[model samples]
Target: MLRSKKGYATALLASSVFLGACASTSGLDGINDATINGSHAQAQGAMGAGAGAVTGAVIGNQMGSSKAGAAIGALVGGAAGYMRGRSLDIKAAQSVAYDARQAGYQAEVNTAVMQNPQTNQSQQVFTGYRVLIPASEIRNQDPEATRILQKTAELAIQADTEVVASGPANLRDSVLTMLNLPAGQAQYVPSNDTKVAVSVMPRRG
Candidate 1:
């Protein structure tokens, strides 16, 4: 009887710690930020942990050991998730590099700072400056402006294929006009300043 009670106590303690860690580390913000920033690792980790915890807890409970099951599940799930996430991140980085080259950028990996106007949160994304540069610059008549315009136009075409618009109302409108995109085709992303706009495209499965 004493041994059974001790086992129960240990399981309860393990379960509490597991639950607390999950609550503290992987909230909605963490998930949303990972997705927004293209941090496949973080996103995958969060997903794996959540799925693993649930599965482990269920199995453990069935075996009369809920706490231990949850703890084990979390560790196993996190590892698997990270591995999958790493694969996805690599593919995504390659795709971005390809897009940069096609858009007339240096074909190098670059980071852009993006802000969510609604949430007022900032995130770093992997993309070329052509997608992040100011529209006014692209509109100038200088030779540099011409080059920027061409690159922006390339991104605009991709955006037209399938992207939703978000960001400053005025900037979004200006981008639509500058790119000559039809109504509802612009994918204006929010930035720290009004002059710069950004767009993010979803990866198709």
Candidate 2:
């Protein structure tokens, strides 16, 4: 009887230790971010760690030895965490960009493409620029937002005409107009994901 009690205690201790480690590491996995970003790809979660921990614990407890269960559980949990994290990160970036575009900024979504530079062999190239333009300048162009929109449309058309096709002036214009600056209102692009608004404390009436 005493031996059985001791074994139970040991199993409980081991499980607790494993769970504690999981909690600590899971935070770093960035699962929450991946889910929010909508870019997480769950590769091992479904079959690996998600199921492993539970199975590992149950089997280990019944068998009065947690080593087997803990190992399997760790493996499964790790994979799930990784996939979940990645997905959220992707989703977050997309969401931010999509909102900006809908509000009248010409937003673009693209990834690196491979093309040859000198040799015929393909080479990877980075795309997209995080540009910053003052809102005051945008407002001065045309309060109507027409000139900018038409310009962007034209740029896009021109790019399509090109064989390799990469025209960003229109894209730049769209972003500039999205600020919707009034007489004195101005904005600065602090980062790719954020914009800053600046205005004179005095009104020019």
Candidate 3:
């Protein structure tokens, strides 16, 4: 009986420490900053711990071991909460990157959804960018043109979009190769002229 009492006390002490740690790590100021910046993992972890404690306490009470139950629950819940929060952060970053690219390019970013014709079900296709690069720019090695193309590629990666280039056959082919895109995935426009236009489309699996 004495050993049981000691175990219960130990469990309660551990639970208190865990709760205290969470509170200190995720204070109100921290949470507010994370929410404003779209980085909520820390806040989510704290919230998860609190929620887990309550749930654990209830379950433990039913089982006559509330403290131990609460401690274990908090650990598990905190991990799951962090993952959910990280996912949200990634989505927010993608959105910001897409918007910035659109504004800088002064071109509308095109989005399309592809559907399975047989099943009549729709799947979201690649969010992509379409831009026209002049043939002269490529020939003269214009730094601004190069920067724009490079930035476009970077943004596509950040936003998880695909690239489509249509212009001088040679330029289009070179860009496609530089992107390491599969030949089968690229759609090239046939032109004997110097003007080149490229549109980055999302890769389909």
Candidate 4:
């Protein structure tokens, strides 16, 4: 059973890499389109200005009416937009929480971009993972406990993020050693709490 669980985790990690690549590409395409559209809007604005100057009275009345309409629409849509964004944030938080609960741990997830030294560019490189493992898991050594910790470490490494783990010395050391975590990629924090909390966060500029 342990071996099968390990295999499943390995397969998930592999598949996630491929899916992540696809998502990145799609995101880049969207960014590009938005940039291009912004430029296009600027050009159109300049053209419209010239046309409006040539037909000032007609254009002025049209602009005034449109501006009034836009203001009213903005008032109507603002609350909806806020609610939609809040809903998305809630769902993302709930998703990680649910996953962690299933694995017999507590967790949080976040996303951020980091600067790249090569081109002096900032890119969305990683999704953060924050996990908490109960102390009883350390005392009892159940398969679920081991699996969750192992999965957390694997995901942090996969995302190329730094992991800060706080827990009992023995539990922390054993988990770190088991994962063979790189010195630069992982950090240990001293904690008196009976639970292990691991935070995986992206590098900041």
Candidate 5:
């Protein structure tokens, strides 16, 4: 215990002498503690600004300023427009046209018209397409399958009749089934026929 006390007292005496020597230094002694802290803060700020400038330059190079921005904007905008063009209504018109041909009819598409389902809002007007089919194709088939195909065709037609577009399910399925209809001049009879629904083959993901 005595030795520990002696050691601590000697350390304090040495620190006091060191401080006293520093107190006699020239202009450094005139500077205050706040000045030292302020100097360190200024150095940190300068380093931060330099780093920020480099990052900004890199970003500018990649994205450009105006012209490059316009190009990128146009590309994205075009892709969005194409996707919108393939919306259900537009596709339904093509579907009906294609499906009619699949059913062995000479089909032609007429421009389609679309309307707003609400409050007679007409501004959403867009042209729809139509298919002109021959009546002979419906003449002979199992009544059940014939009815399904006819119903689907009608649904596809009705969907585009005014404005609202129907989903592809009806037309797609019917087209596939019509393409596969057995070739014969047989009349439809419900008891022997199955009410099988035709489906549109989906695109591979």
Candidate 6:
């Protein structure tokens, strides 16, 4: 029975990896499309399995069946890791929103939790805020508008969140394109998914 359980757990992990890979290829299949910066499912699964195995072994030894304990531990650990990943996503989003608010933008922020079809797990997702800057203000190239955006980006960096400005079709495209480019690079693609236009800066440790 213990051996059977162990095998089942192993199979589950393998299945999870396969599913996650499949999900990654589909834009809408994984956790909230807007919140995924990169794939972390495999890493999270491995870590969970390792931690669970060790913990289960320890407990099983006490109960005269380390193998059984390990299988149970693996399941628990995997779930925990998935939850942690989701929480981190939310925290990062919230931090960015807060920073934007402090910079005087009327920031709209919200949290979401969803299941990832690939990993068969639930994750926390944060939809980044939309800063309500008027179309007229943006078109005028208002200095104050520029300052607000600049400060928001700086604050986002400090808070470890990416800033994606969404508003006014023409102005939004222009500003996001400028912000998304590298310091010397001038290429910018206009996007309907404005949430992804974060001016990513190197994270400070």
| Highest-TM-score candidate | 4
TM-scores, all models, native as reference: 0.34, 0.28, 0.38, 0.44, 0.24, 0.42
What tens-digit string does per-residue lDDT give for candidate 3 at 1-205?
4544564565455434432332111101111111224335566667877887787677666666778657755765564454344434433334433443443433334433333221233322224445555677766656656666665555445434456666666676565544454345455676776656655543443
Per-residue lDDT tens digits for candidate 4, residues 78-153, read 3222223222332333344455677756665553433322123334432455677786776577677777666556
* lDDT of the structure predicted as candidate 1: 0.45
Q: C-alpha displacement of 68 in model 1, angstroms?
A: 5.0
Ranking by lDDT: 3, 6, 4, 1, 2, 5
lDDT per residue (tens digit) for residues 1-205 in model 6: 5665665566466545532432221111122223334323335656876897788778767767777778766765665554455445444445544555555555554434544433556555433334555545556766655655664454443334545444445665657543443343222334454232333321222
* lDDT, residue 106, candidate 3: 31
Worst 10 residues of 5 by lDDT: 27-36
TM-score quality measure for candidate 4: 0.44
Residue lDDT tens for model 5, 67-110: 33333333333322222332333334445445545655433333
Clashes of each: 0, 21, 15, 0, 9, 1
Off by over 4 Å in 2: 1-51, 58-65, 104-205
Off by over 4 Å in 1: 1-64, 71-83, 106-131, 134-170, 176-205
What is candidate 6's local distance difference test score? 0.49
- Give, for candidate 1, the lowest lDDT window spanning 10 residues: 24-33
Alpha-carbon runs more than 4 Å astray in model 6: 1-3, 6-50, 56-79, 113-128, 140-166, 181-205
- Residue range with the least summed lDDT across 10 consecutive positions in model 3: 24-33
Q: For residues 1-205, could you state the per-residue lDDT of candidate 1 as single tens digits?
A: 4544564465455434432332111101111111113555567768887887787788677767777667656766665564455434433444543444454443332333333211233434333222444445544433543444344444434422223433455565555555565555455665546344444343332
Model 6 weakest lDDT span, ten residues long: 22-31
Candidate 5 stretches with Cα past 4 Å from truth are 1-87, 112-134, 142-205
- As a whole number from 0 to 100, the lDDT of residue 2 in candidate 6 is 68
lDDT of 2 by residue, 81-173 (tens): 433433233333344334434445544422232222112233222122121223433434534344433323232222211111122333333
Could you tell me how far off, in angstroms, the CA of residue 167 lies in candidate 2 after the best superposition?
A: 22
